[model samples]
Target: MSERKPQVLLIGFGGVGTIVSYTLEHLGRAEVTVVSRPETYDSIKSGYRIESCSYGIIDNYIATNVVKSTKEGYEKYGPFDYIIITTKNIPEISPVVDFLEDCYHESSTIVLIENGIGIEIPIYRKYPKAIILSGVSLIGTTLYEDTVKHIARDIIKFGAFINYNLDKQMQYDRCKHFLSLYSNDNNFAEYEENVKLTRWRKLVYNTCINTTCALTDLDFGRMDLFGGMESVVRPAMKEVVAVAKSEGVEIEDHVIDEMIRGEDGVYYPPSMLIDVRNGNYIENTVIISNVVKYAKRNGVPIPTLTVLDNLLKLVQLRTGEAKGRFELPEKRPLPEENYQIQFKY
Candidate 1:
């Protein structure tokens, strides 16, 4: 057996893959291979370049390798120990199945770091023997050529579900392994047993931020203070709480209110807003529709979310969204008193 670094296979060489790969590279312990679409693979293999304000300038054409499809991807550089998926939700599950069918073994671990809630159960039911992990990523990275523009300083949450009856020691071992990868970095990773609850919590935040941001065509900072937009956030949050409560995800009404009031006032743009700005397909299927489905299942009325969902669908239909153009913004301005005050929560 060869004594070599652990091998990592990343599906979709988008922003998430960039950040994860950059981290893995800096950690100096993994051979990272990114599997992208044919068009993207060509671009990456030639040389990857990510121009960003945060990381100064990144050009990774030399180190990174990209291939198309799981079969070719695995054959060229895999039998990977870890597969991290950062694609949006609609096609997320399918490629995972393809990766598993073509290359992965019983020991390979799959980590999903995309938007949406409640996707894991279906994936788990089908791949009962596979090691499945779910996660939330706060780091933002976008692709420019083969390199990824990475915005550091974000937390990542990872773990298995509460309903999973897998061996506790195995779960702990997985957590330990992941932490070993990132623990030394400034931003930390935490593993939880109640990953479902964690997913729902992040979902609520996304439901409010993503829907409103896309519909109103505003980033977080603008919507947070937009008189008309901020007014709608509270009511939307009320509906989210009602639905979440029905689903047994306990979030205090006040905390929900605070989240909306706080996040909106600051200027962090959601992925939906970015996608819309860039003329990409909106992720309405998973975020907006799934919330409505879960609310209906629990007999909880989420009128606000439903209304926003419908409005966003109309916006997507009429405008035909796209991904945001990667123009690095000027330096962030000093926070105003209100902005500073709102973020205290």
Candidate 2:
């Protein structure tokens, strides 16, 4: 028998998926198959386009196959080596969980490249056979009918949550498989060890920037100049740091604060803000309520987080969206402030 070429199935053919598809195609390592709703599939098959503001050109991408949501989406294009998901977390994750159950397998790896905190464990509980990876993306994409406007240089950080230390070669092989999709451009992917901290750190930054920008209806550039935003931002960061500490993870306040300032302090609108602008479901429960729960558990008072959580709840209530499906997790009290601000190297 002839050797088989590597294959990848991309879920959520929205902004991020388009970028991944563009990069993977340019790299030319694996055959890409996109699984999206029917309308998105038609657009990709007919000819999907990407116009990059920074990169300076509109390019068209054609995938090997396009199928709407069905077992056929997986059955026809799978036994895929990797499934890269960029979908948002909503409705307590029922739809995505069902999708994963239908599509996940031991031979396939699922990489979550989306927003929010505290989502991976539930996925693991449901799909233990598949290798799960969590990632943080710092790229921006705007949609424009059968095309996405790639707004910034792609900065993707990803890593797996492996249970045991596998042999070096096995680990390297898995890493290599992932890197292949972005090999043509080394700027897109980085393998990180402190992946959980990385994810939480990014979330903390987003929670501040996205919510603030959305509320103020301003972009990051102007928002950065606004006075007293730090009062809200710093307090939220403290809650995030406290939660990380409770989980035995140490994250510096300055690191989180600086992270809130994006690349060159670029005035980009965050995903949450984008969702609110689009009138879509927001991640109030995961991002806001979780912080409140953790702070209450640690005996650390998060006055600002409570306020923000209440504000988010008001937004949901006024919009008549899904409210509080996730039960508040048990609280873990934080120790007294005996820590010094250790400078990050």
Candidate 3:
């Protein structure tokens, strides 16, 4: 008798998906299958290519299997060991429960490698028996044309999502097994005991830089060139810390200084900015609105975040109307708030 390799199914094959798949393949830790869009699936079927600054170039790294949707994937490769979702955390627009409902099994653990806090609540509501994990992704990646590119390296904080609305603990066995797949220094993967606290820490950077750059239609390098670090960026980043504290998640004050370091200023565009420019749905509800929701519930005042939230909602409306992706380049002005203090409840 021989040992069977772990069976891992990822619901997306974009930048994050490709990078994670490559890492898993290199380690020979799992038999990786991908559920991709029609276009991405076709591309993979013909020939899958990945370009990376870290791993050089891989022309054809064969996957175990590639399917178009979760239903198809489940029918073919049912009862996976692990399911990793790399799509955006947009519940209202594109609920994950739709695709992931059939994909999870009794023993399958789902890992989310997307951005935003307050994202797992809905999933917990749908699948009470399923174990979910959050991957606080800090790595820099981009999907262009048909290639997945890894521009820089960072860490992914992994922890179990025991409760929907609150932070607590469950069996650490699954989490430990997942982390053990990678070497200690391989790709900077870490197991986080307090995942919610880590979520808040990442939020300071995402809520501030991602929303601002996304709305302004500017990259980090352009923001540096225009010089808004102390005036705009710092204030926004500082506000996140306050909201996190009100929610009982204490992020050190000095993180603002660390976030403002010079090296972070680069030509890269954050995920939100890329989503907006591509006419894709922005993650306003989960990222910005949820923070405001928690802050108001805790009676914490985040005037700056309030302004940013409102401004973003209005911009999101225009984006929906303009159909930014299909709209002509010239008409879609290469540029761009909302203030609403309400919860999804």
lDDT (tens digit, per residue) of candidate 1 on 1-345: 967877777786676666666666665767778777876656766756665444456655333556677777688877778877777775322434554567676667777777777666565766776677777877767775555666655478888543245776686677668657755445567777667677777777788778888877898778877763457766777777777778778876667756666532348778898888876666776677777888999888777888888887666544332223122225544656233211110
In order of TM-score, best first, we have 3, 2, 1
lDDT of 3 by residue, 43-161 (tens): 76665577777677988766778888777888888788889988887766577767677787878888888778888777777877778888888787777766777877757888886
Could you tell me the lDDT of residue 1 within candidate 1?
94
Those runs of model 3 whose alpha carbons end farther than 4 Å from true positions after fitting are: 164-170, 183-185, 225-227, 324-345
Clashing residue pairs, backbone N/CA/C < 3 A, model 3? 309-338, 310-337, 310-338, 310-339, 311-337, 311-338, 312-337, 312-338
Using TM-score as the measure, which candidate wins? Answer: 3
Whole-model lDDT per candidate: 0.68, 0.68, 0.77
Model 2, runs deviating above 4 Å: 53-58, 91-95, 163-173, 260-267, 296-299, 320-345
lDDT assessment of candidate 2: 0.68
Worst 10 residues of 1 by lDDT: 336-345
lDDT of 2 by residue, 198-255 (tens): 7778767766667766666677767767753575676677777777787667887678
User: Which model is ahead, 1 or 3, in terms of lDDT?
Assistant: 3
Please give the lDDT score at residue 26 for candidate 1.
62
Cα deviation at 132, candidate 2, in Å, is 0.6
